[model samples]
Target: MRYDVVVIGSGFGGSVAALRLAEKGYSVLVLEAGRRFADHELPRTSWRVRRFLWAPALGCYGIQRITLLRPAGRRGAGGSRAGGTGRGKTRAGQSGGRAGVLVLSGAGVGGGSLVYANTLYEPPADFYADPQWAGITDWRAELAPYYARAKQMLGVVDYPRTTAADKVMRAVADRMGAGDTFRSTPVAVYLGRPGERVADPHFGGAGPDRAGCTHCGSCLTGCRVGAKNSLPKNYLWFAERAGARIRPLTTVVGLRPGPGGAGYLVDVRRTGAWAGGRQTIAADQVVLAAGALGTQRLLHTARATGALPAISARIGALTRTNSEAILGASVPRRAARRRRLDFTDGVAITSSFHPEPGTHVEPVRYGPGSNLMGLLQSALVPGGPCRVRRWLAALAGRPRDTVRLLSVRDWSRRTVVALVMQSVDNSLTTYHRRGRLVAGHGHGRSNPSWIPAGHRVVRLLADEIGGIPGGAVTEPFDVPMTAHILGGAVIGATRADGVVDAYHRVFGCPGLHVLDGAAVPANLGVNPSLTIVALAERAVAHWPVKGAPDRRPPAS
Candidate 1:
């Protein structure tokens, strides 16, 4: 079948592109690799633990596991596919191997928006002024209108400061003497009048009506309360209404220029255990919105096969992990207050503090079923060969005991989970190897500005609130983790310096464009979902449709 636009991947970038293009009267088809999930389909209790974590054999969640290998000398090894046909399939059909480094990301309809903490902040001014961004377009002016559009679409709002957790965090910030940096995080949620819901209120009755946020702490576990404003509830939902067909559990495997036309042919597979099949889609325009890892892998494979050799060499360069860390502490409550009620009940990240330059700290809350508290307890136990060893031992021995102890203790009353981040510019690159995206390892210089700032905030928390010091953790490392990953296929002035031009069009390919985080030139020092949405809006706006065109002919 043919579409005016074929969008691969349905995360922030893909979602926005699909919606905007469809709104412009284009016949759009969105191919997503993961299955569509409703709130009920998501696990709300411990009984459904398997659904929360990814495992190929057990009907994995959308998060893909990645490995970071040391760069292969000057000349890297030729990339190849590991197993059957390079097609996505049920767990039984997937290749059996482990990645050297494991990076987690969401798949399915909403993409990372499903699992990400909805924190939205603007990029620093210096980000737009950088030489890397100057050549593509005047990012500052181009992005302004779109950012406003994205904000209105996502229902971005600030915390009410009414929750007890918010007050405590503010008090802690004040005691630290760096209280001036404390502010309500701008989140994508509604805070309007009671019982009255309106969709697309900002667009004059064109969007969906999102019920206001109830402040449920279960945003991570899937907001069953209809409060947390996720993309599925807004943009993607509206896009479907506007006539875009969202094909979930459909993974695109290959892309080749359309037979004698200004378009391309896309190969896709329906993934599942019951039954699966393959199909081809033809499109006049293709927008690659798959996140950094997914898009890099797809583009690399396409380029390597002579499908599009004109693809710039800088395709997988400037990758950044947003320079984030998860630092948290536990506050033990008196035995009398332990069993009263669930303090975590209506709290969805209520406060934040920046104790020093370049550092950001915020309260992290977990639902009843989240094992985060147990993880924190394990990290706190003293004594072991090393921090890793100690953490392993704690994980094995103390998780249950600590949970039982905390179940009776009022930790939520006195404790606030904090995440500390520095605006350090360290980054890594990603490339395709054996049909998969792999990150190259090696730490760039750690920015001292973030470290000192982080330490200052940590010290204040420990001293003022009498909270215990904790360490950082990510997917492979037992430290904290972040959902924001940016860069890779960056935008540049010329094909030699970057993959796409200022307009987000491929350096050489005319009808091909990349309109997602992959186009971001630098880390925004904040969650990137909102920025991606805005950028996508700007991209589609630049390419206004001139009525619908005829479908491209089939391949010979």
Candidate 2:
């Protein structure tokens, strides 16, 4: 089937494109490689592997996807599939480029929105001043209107009330002598009456009704209460009503110039289906929004096979991790029980603080009964023995405190996760060697795994709450972990410098666009979703309708 456009990966970028084009009377088809889930259909806890993990070969199809991005050196030995999920899986290798980076991204119709804590933030001025694309335009000024419009469209608002986690963050900031920097986080949610259904709150009667946030703290596990402002509830929903077709569980594997000047031919296959179910569809334009990893993987394979000969050699340049690190602290169960502070009482992330210039720290949570932290976090310092042996020995030495911090069932209520990011200038390169996408240190120094300012904030957070400190498992290996992955296939001045132009149109690939994190030229110190949406709004605003001149965007 042919359409005006075919968008791969309905994430922040693709959702914006789908809604805007469909609203403009264009034929749009959004091909999502994951399943479409209704609010009621989402998993209630992260412990349900069959409903929480994204492993197709093991027959466990769910939202959260964890990919082990091995360094380029360890390639040959670990390049084998996990039974049959297609891409060669590498045994988690030692710290290296993207430095021992482990990618935890969302896989579903709404992309990362299916799993992201709804905290929304705009990057600091440093993000705009990066030399890579600073000369392109007055970016901060140029993107201002688009950013405001995106916030409105996303239903962003300040979290209405405070929670135990909020107080802890406030205390942490005070101790840092940065109390002025602490504030309730701005999030995409309906902060109306908890669980009460209300008419369309964002769009004027054009979007779906919503339920107020229940402070269930399950936002990360897919907001079963229907209050979180996920894409399907807004952008994608409006696009569908305006005639956009959403085909889920369909992965695009190949792209080339189409026959009879149809513009482009997109080769696709059913995701997780048996082999040989491929099909081709034509479109006048194709937008790649399959996120940082997904889009880069697809483009690398295409260019290597001569399917996209004009692709720039800089396709993998300047990829970023937002200079992020995940560290945390947990209160002892006895103390938590006495103090009656439930870390899991409010939304996933309710408050944040900046300990020093360019450093941001936010407290994150998961509702009761969700203990996936047991899988992602380890003791802040890895030492004498395995984590199990360490925990067992510690339990024998300090039973109450050890059991309080280590209990799987109570981890959520007793723990506070510190999401740290900085505006430091650093990046990495991605390669599609040996049929797998791997990262290597690029440009400046490798991304920082230890930020003194960030760790100081987490430590203070733990001390204030009277808890034990822990960090990302990969941290001890001199690597960072993050959910906010950006860059690769970035915008540049010319075909020789970058893969795309300032407006997100590929340099040599006509009618091809990349509007996701992959196109961001530099590291954004905050969550990148709002930036991706604003960039898409700016890019698509330049697209002229079929057989007509481009119309001016309405004033905000």
Candidate maximizing TM-score? 2
Residues 224-311, candidate 1: write the lDDT tens digits: 5555667787789888998999988777788889998569999888665354587889999899987877787778888988898878
lDDT of 2 by residue, 1-556 (tens): 9999999989999999999988878899999988889888888898877777898778767888888776665442222111111111111221223345777788898998888998888888977876667778999999999999899988899987889888878988888898998888889988888889988877887788888889989988898888889999888998999899999989898888888645899999988987988999899999999999898988888898888878887887777788788888987767778888778888888888888777788888998888876556655643222544654465477666555555655778888999887676666777788688877766545566666676677777788888887777676556678888888888776776678888788877877889999999776767888999999999888777656875633211
Candidate 1 Cα errors over 4 Å, as ranges: 45-47, 54-56, 62-104, 192-209, 273-276, 332-347, 372-415, 441-452, 462-467, 473-480, 547-556
lDDT of each: 0.63, 0.80
Candidate 1's displacement at residue 501, Å, is 1.0
Q: What clash pairs does model 2 have?
A: 96-99
Judge candidate 2 at residue 209 and give its lDDT: 86
Worst 10 residues of 1 by lDDT: 81-90
How many backbone clashes can be found in candidate 2? Answer: 1
Q: What TM-score does prediction 1 earn? A: 0.80
